[model samples]
Target: MKSALMGSLKFQIPQLNFHKTLKKPRPSFLRGRPRPPLWRAKRLSTEAIQAIQSLKLARSSAPRLEEVFNNKLSRLLKADLLDTLAVLQNQNELDLALKVFEFVRKEGWYKPDILLYHAMIQLMGRNKMVEMAEEFFGKLENEGLKPDTRAFTEMIGAYLQVGIIDKAMETYERMKASGCDPDKLTFRILIRNLEDAGKEELVDCIKKECGKEAGGRFFLKISSAQNGKVAVADLQYHVLKCQKARNFAVSSCEADLISTLLKLQSRRAHASR
Candidate 1:
């Protein structure tokens, strides 16, 4: 009877269909779509490249070169034309670059761009073509554009490149009289070049001017902060930190005053709060 009951209780167990429940692996390409390539500005177009080649090959005669420039290069878009000019300048082809520059200037769409003049001046300076650089600068002024600091700085640099110290100093004075204050860069360039030229007196004068400007600017900020009820200590500390970070030197008197003001302001801020 026991054996018969055991035989009756025996039943078939169903197997699990895991293949139907689990997902199949995807192909490598489908797992994640490939990222698109990054876009970048094209340095030069086909037309520009062709125009440059034509200009270079037409170097036999000025009239023939002018014809090639007019026929091929004049039709390029503004960007392409400027890019071509920049390429010529970088290649140190002074004559070709000047031709392109003059052509660009004559364009109806042309406007006074100080940066363009700056680049040309820099290029001419590198080639020791100080006269050409001066001509370009005169043209810049004739265009009724007030020379900014960079433009003046470039002209000064060009003068200095030819060891024309008097001209450089005159340009610097004109820059100041034009109400374009000399920035740190202007001071730096003047000081460095003057020192190299062994002009000790001029270097001292420049340093004094720089110090006066820095002090006035700093104290102006402090006065403004006081009016705003800002903690003088914090402002002074921040200024000192910035000065140190920028490798600026602070005199002992200035540092002591800053520390004293910082302490006084800290106490005042605490008392008020």
Candidate 2:
């Protein structure tokens, strides 16, 4: 009787169809959200193109280039002239770019612009034309325009590119003396390049300088994990890790004199209280 009752009671097990249960994702366009178009550089106007060609052709002869500029390119709108110069710089046409730059400088509407000088210095630096970069920097100074951090950094970078560590350090000192404070980029550029060149002493000096500049607020620490080479680690909220310093080891006190200064400052604060 028990067996018969158990056989009479049948439990139904429903099968789950996951394929029908899960909804497929719709394409962005179908969902009324399309991806934004990628940005492309603006094409140069016909007149600008012609002017660049003319300048390039006349580059062989200085007098011919001057004549071409005065006759054909001089009448260009300020916007057009600046744009043409930018294009020349992007193309790495240093000589032509300088020629155009001189013309732009002589324009009645022109003013001393540090950013323009910075761009030219960057271009020269990339080509390892250190002297030309210095010349442009000097011209900027002569124009009574105070060089900003970016301008100074580019000049420093130019020096570094030519493997002239001494000049780079001198430029950094000059930048400080001129009352232009070095930003994080300045420190990073100095530290990374100095480290790569095995100028560990200079790196230590920069670390202390940074601490002094920050007034004991922010500081950088150096670690040595890979082959016992020094690596910089920012102790603040954002850690600026050097690419070469992938593996982090214990922080070294000798590398972090900034922390020692901070400790003294803290002790003094307590003592004054």
- Taking all chains together, each candidate's TM-score versus the true structure is 0.63, 0.59
The deviation in Å at residue 126 for candidate 2 is 2.2
Residue-by-residue lDDT tens digits, candidate 2, 36-132: 3211366677778788889888999989998889887898888778878988887779989988898889999999898799889988887889999
Off-target runs (Cα >4 Å) in candidate 2 are 1-43, 61-64, 207-273
- Write down the worst ten-residue block by lDDT for model 2: 242-251
Where does candidate 1 clash, by residue pair? 233-262
lDDT of 1: 0.71
Cα miss at 243, model 2 (Å)? 26
Candidate 2 yields a Cα-based lDDT of 0.73
- Highest lDDT scorer: 2
